[model samples]
Target: MDNFSFYDLQPKISNFPDEVLAGLSKQQKQIPPKFFYDEYGSKIFDQICELEEYYPTRTEFGILQQHSSDIADQIGENSLIIEYGSGSSQKICFLLDSLIKPWAYMPIDISREHMLSASKTIADKYPNLKVLGVYADYTTEMLLPEYAISSVQKKVIFFPGTTIGNLEPEEAIQLLKRSAMIVGSCGGMLIGFDMKKDPQILHASYNDSKGVTAAFNINLLTRINRELEASFDTNTFTHYAFFNPQKSRIEMHLISLVEQTVVISDRLFNFLEGESIHTENSYKFSVQEIENMSERTGFKLIRFWTDPKKHFYPG
Candidate 1:
C-alpha cells in the first residue's frame, strides 16, 4: 500500500493581498512570478504547455525520454526525489520510471489543493512509492519530513521545467546553494535549464495564437479578485509579453487599458492608462552560464542532455 502525507505550510487564505498591495506600491510595479499558480492559473499553465508554440515542456520531455536511463545510472539507487514546484508531477514520472528503488517522493509547492491532488494520483500509479506533499513556497527555507531526511540513502533534488529561470541570477545561485545543503554531500541535483534561443522563438512561446498564455497571465488578477475581495476588471487588463534582448528575458505584464482604481480590503491602488504590472520574467541561459552557476553553487555537473536542436537542456 502507498502511504501519502500532506503538510500545509501555506495559509488557507493566501497572503496574496499583502503581496499585491506591496507590489502595486512599488515605483515599478511588479508581482513575483510565483503568484501565478493559484488553482485556475495552474490549470491555464497546463494548457499553455500543450500549445504548439510552447516548446520547453515538450523539448525537456524528449531529453528526459532519451536520457532517463543514463540519468538513473548517475542518480544511483535508493534515492529520495524532492521536487520543487512539483506542478502536475508529470515530468518526474520519467525519472521515477528509471530510478532504482527510489525510496520516496517529496513534492513541495505553494498550491496545496493541486499538490495534494497530484500527489494522490502519483501515489496511485507508483503503488510502492511513498509520496509526501509539502504545501509551502519552496523559495523560502523549508523543513523536510523527518522520515525523508533520516531514512533515505540518497537525496536527489529533481527541479525540472527550467523553473529556476524565473529567479534572478543571485536568487538562483542562493537556491542552488540551498538545494545543495538539503541534498547533502553524497547526493546530486538533476535540473533543467531553458537555453538561450532566437528572440522570435522566445517571443512566440509566451504569446501563443490561441491566447492561452494571455489568459494564464490575466488569471493572476482573477485570483486576487476571488481571494482578496478585490474589484479588478480583468477584461480591462490586457496581457503583454515580450523578449527583452538586453536582459535576455521574456517579460510578461498586465497592461491597464484604462485609468482605474482597484480596492482590496479598504486599500486603493490606482493605475493610469497604459500603466502595467510586471507579472513574470523567464530568463534564458547559455550552457556556459549554467556551468558557471553550478560551479558557483558547489554542484559538479556530471552530465547534461539536450535536444538536437538545442532548445532545452535537462542535466
Candidate 2:
C-alpha cells in the first residue's frame, strides 16, 4: 500500500456531541450538514445522487465528460487533485482518465471510514498515482501532508459536487480562504454549482417522488439518537423540502408531527407540533456569483462550463 495512506486530523466522532448540542440550542434549531456523513449517512447520500429526480450528479458528470480533457489541460501535468467532501469518488474518474499525469489524489472528508474506503478503491484503480486519504473537515483550517506538496507541479482543488452550496456565503469564503492555505500561492479550485433555474425543478429535486430523500434527511436524526444517546421518535418527524426562491436555495427540514421532548445525554430539548429542525441548504448560483466568490476568497475564476441543457456548471 505504498501508494496509499490515510491521515485522521480529528478523532472519531470527537466533536459530534458538542456540535449537536450547540446546533439544537439555537433559537431556530439547526444542524450543520457536515454531520450528515457518518458511515451510514454517507452511503444514504450516495443513493441520493442516483435518484432520477436528483439531477446535479449526472448533469455535472456530463459536463466533465464533455470537457475533461480541456479541464485537464488547465490542470496540466504532474498535478494534485484534492476533492472536498470526497463522496463515492465516482465523478472524479472522468477527469482522472483524461488528465496527463496526476501526481497525487487527496480525498478530504469528515467521515474517516468513507474517505479511507473511497481512497483505497481509487488507489487500486490508479496504481501509479499516489492516494492520500485525509480524514478532516475541509471547512476547518489545515494543510496537506508536509511531504505531499514538495513534488507536485500544480495543486488544484477538485470540488465537483456543488457541496459549497451547503455553506452560507461568509462560511464559504472562510472555507475557500482555508483551501487557499493548502493549495499555496498559485493553486486553484475547480468547483461545481447549480445555477438559478426553475424553482419548481429545484423543488422537485429535493422533494423526490421516491422516499429516498426522506430517508436521507431522517438519517441525521438517527445518527444523533444513536451516537449521542438521544431519544428521538423518528416516526413522529416528517421530511420537508422546498425551494426558497428569495434566497435561491433549497432548504430541507425535519418537521415534528407531535409535540415532544427528546433527551440527549440528560439534556432536554422540547419541540412543538409542526416545529422544524433545519437540516440542510443547497444554494444555486449564477456564473457571476461564483466569480464573485472567487474574487472574495482571493482565487481567480479562470473558466466555467456547462452541460448542453445548461442545468449545471463547473468552474
Candidate 3:
C-alpha cells in the first residue's frame, strides 16, 4: 500500500447522502457536479473527452506539449508538483519530462482506485521519481502532509482541465486562496481556465450530437440511484445544456420528461413535467478575468498558453 499512498475515502462518502439531500432540498433542485465522477461517470467522461465536439482535453493537451519547457522554466528544479486531479494523462508526463529534478509529485482525487492506479503507474514509469497519490475531495479545503512540498522547498500546484471554470467566481477565488496557503507565498500555480468564445461552440461542447455528454450528465442520476438508494427514473429525464452568453458560462440541467415523485433518504420529492435540476456550470473567462482572479486570490498571473482562437488556456 505504501507504493500507492492511498487515503481512506469513507469520510467523503459519509457526507454524500447529506450533500445530495441538501442540494435537492433547495427551490432550484441541484446536485454538485462533483457527484458526476463515480466509476461509470468517470469512464463516460473519458469517452466524452474523445468526442469531436469536446475540444478541451485535446486543446489543453496541446498547450501542455507546446509550453512544457516554458512552464517547467517557471517551476524550476527540486520542486514538488501538487496536482489537484488524477494525473494519469500525458499532461503530468510532459511536465515531469521537462522539469529538472522534481522532488515529488502528488496527485489528488476523490476516487481511491483512480488515485492509487495512477500513482502506481507513474511510480512504475519513473522508478526513481516519487509519486504520492492522495484520495480526497480537492474541492473542499485541504491540508496536505507537512512533508508534501514543505515550506523549505519550491512547490507548484498544477490544476489542469477546465475544472476551475466549473466553480462560481467567488468559490474559485476562495479555492485559489486555499491553494496559495498550501504552496505558501513563494509557490506558483499553473491552472486551466476556459475562455469566453462562440456560444455555438460552447453549446456543442457540452451537448454533443453523439450524446456522450448527455450520458455523462445523466450518469449523476444513475449514481444517485445506485449509491443513495434514490428512485430516479433516469430514462424520464433528458440532458439539457446551453450557453448563457451574459454569464459567459455553459449550464447543464436534467429536465424531467413528466411529472413524477422520487424518494431519497426516506424523503419524498416532487418534480413537474418541465422541472429541472441544475447540475453543473462551466464559466468561461477572459485573460483580464483570470488576472483579476489571481490578484484577488493573493497570487500573480505568470505565463499563459492558448490557441489562436482563445477557446481555452491551461498554464
**Which one is best on TM-score?**
3
What TM-score would each prediction reach against the true structure?
0.92, 0.92, 0.92
Q: How close is candidate 1 to the true structure, as a TM-score?
A: 0.92
Model 3 TM-score is 0.92
- Cα lDDT tens digits for candidate 2, 1-315: 789988877735547799889999998999888778777876888888898988998899889999999999988988889998886788889999999988899888876776788899999999998998998877777756777777775799999877789889788889888877778777788888888888888888898888888998899999999988899999999999988878888999999999999999999999999999999999999888888888888888888889877788888
Please, what are the lDDT tens digits per residue for candidate 3 over residues 1-315? 333355443434547788889988999999989888877887999899899999899998888888899888888988888888774645789898899888888888776776777788888888767777787777787667665646347888889899998999888988999898888777889898888888888889998989999999888998999988999999999999999888889999999999999999799999999999999999999889888888998888878888777878875
Return the candidate ranking by lDDT, descending.
1, 2, 3
- Clash pairs, candidate 3, are none
Q: lDDT per prediction?
A: 0.88, 0.87, 0.84
Pairs in clash, predicted candidate 1: none
Q: Give the TM-score comparing model 2 with the true structure, all chains together.
A: 0.92
Candidate of highest lDDT: 1
Tell how far residue 103 is off in model 1, in angstroms: 2.4
